[model samples]
Target: MTLYLHLGAHKTATTLLQNVLKHNEAALEERGLARIKIQPRHLFWHLYRDGDRDAFKKRRRTLARKLQQYYKSWPNAVLSSETMFGTSDLHRVNCLYPRADTALRVLAQLTSGMNRKVIFYVRRQDNFIESSFINRLQTLATSLHLDHAQLLSDTTWCSFEHYLSSFTPSQLSWLHLIKRMEAHFGAENLIIRPFESIHRGNAAYAESFLAPMCATHDLELAPQVYENRSFSAKALEEFIRLAPKQGFANLRSLRLHLQDKYPNTSYPRPMLLSPEQRQEILQTLATENSILFEQYFSDVDRTDISYQPVGS
Candidate 1:
């Protein structure tokens, strides 16, 4: 069976894509495909976090058996998860997805001998970093299941400037992540998409993400249901100030409450970086972006990937 593994650089509409696949399971099955859902924690811990080789071997074998069962039902399947790359907590100012290579290596071992194709969505480095910072803050506030010592660390909740200050703009390179992916999953097997292309409030946006993974543009997709909307700027500031004071359960509940109260659609996204900084981020990566486009996206419409700041 051919496995389409969607390794998300999060904040790239990954959750919405996952939901659409689940909603359209019947449609996919009719097309000789299926969406195989796995708990994020399983991959995060067993594959990415754990260093126990013997334990990981046993776990990998167990997961392989589970996947074989899925393949018995459907000849082609997609396994989608951002955690397949690494956890949000791994993000630091100086390093982006520091454990990405390790995680990909572990995943490569798990899916050995299978016809595996990797599906990835690349976002602009500036926007990607800002969004990831907001996501980390959200996780810190709501992830009560994590150990308090780790979860409550000051660095985890540090200001966006502090986070960005840790790494030079030149260090923010998609090439590093893409190279790691190619090393493990062959360059020919990668289906990379620019996140900006179909992200312009398109109702059928999920189709763009899904069709590539399923290897069919002729899919009959259900209506896209938006999920995991970003918190508005005002809401984010208020949430941050209040988050440190609340207990975990309360903070989690508050986050849910605020999601409905101040969805990104209703207000501007949090602007952690000034326009100057945003430009610096873009200028710093211009050559890198050009190389990325020239190498991987020669056939596609290169104009759509300006990595322009939203609402600019």
Candidate 2:
């Protein structure tokens, strides 16, 4: 069996892709592909061999056995999980797919194993940072009382510097990550995509990139998938305003609690900065995220892609 794994680096249209796949599951199945649905739809740990401790490991060995059973039942499976990209626990992953390689090494390992393919889409640093901040604020508002200014000021809240504390600039840079993964996996086995190209109303970009893998597995492409959600900057500001008053201490707890309260909340709009604020935030990000930004921009220029239109 061949596995097509999409490891999201976050805030890069993962939800869009998942929605597309889920919406077109029937078409995908006709093409000899399966979405591998586990109950609770959003949860992916059910597919891994290790029981999810965060969810109480309810099924434990039974879940793992079921996953293995399904895995063996199909010749081609596409498994996706954004959380997989954030985790540093190699043991948890190894336990699931014993022969699977790390995201940084999966490309080369695919040649010997069940023909593996890794697909990753990355957003430019500036846009990614801005959007990520709003995401954090909306995420924080559920539990804590937070406003835009406070969230921006709190180093522990959301900032390029804070993220760098956990992941090195090199490790976090998509260009570097791709290079390292390609070095181990073989360039042919890895696919790198820019966020701009995929979002440019070109629904075929995803299918084009996945075509080779699909052909290898005798799978067909589904019809074009459209985005149902619209981007909103105003909504983000409102979320930020509601944050601090919510009284949650950290983002993690705040997110869970917020989901419980507003289960249907969509992506908050991008926060719009005034001219002065935009310049100030840009300068701050540039200074605080110098190493990472430089690396990230260098890759952007080399790739010759922009997530937004000129002047946007």
RMSD of each: 3.3, 8.9
For every model shown, the clashing-pair count is 0, 15
Candidate 2 has its poorest 10 consecutive residues by lDDT at 88-97
| Per-residue lDDT of model 1, residues 101-167, tens digit only | 7668867877778888898888888788788777777776444234534545575455788777767
In model 1, how large is the Cα lDDT of residue 263? 85
Q: For candidate 2, lDDT tens digit of each residue in 51-136?
A: 46565334434444544554577666676665543322211121212222343342233234456667766665556545555454
Among all windows of 10 consecutive residues in model 1, the one with the lowest summed lDDT is 141-150
Clashes of 2: 15
RMSD in angstroms, candidate 2? 8.9
Question: Largest TM-score belongs to which candidate?
Answer: 1
How many angstroms is residue 83 displaced in model 1 relative to the true structure, after the best TM-score fit? 0.8
**Whole-model lDDT per candidate:** 0.72, 0.49
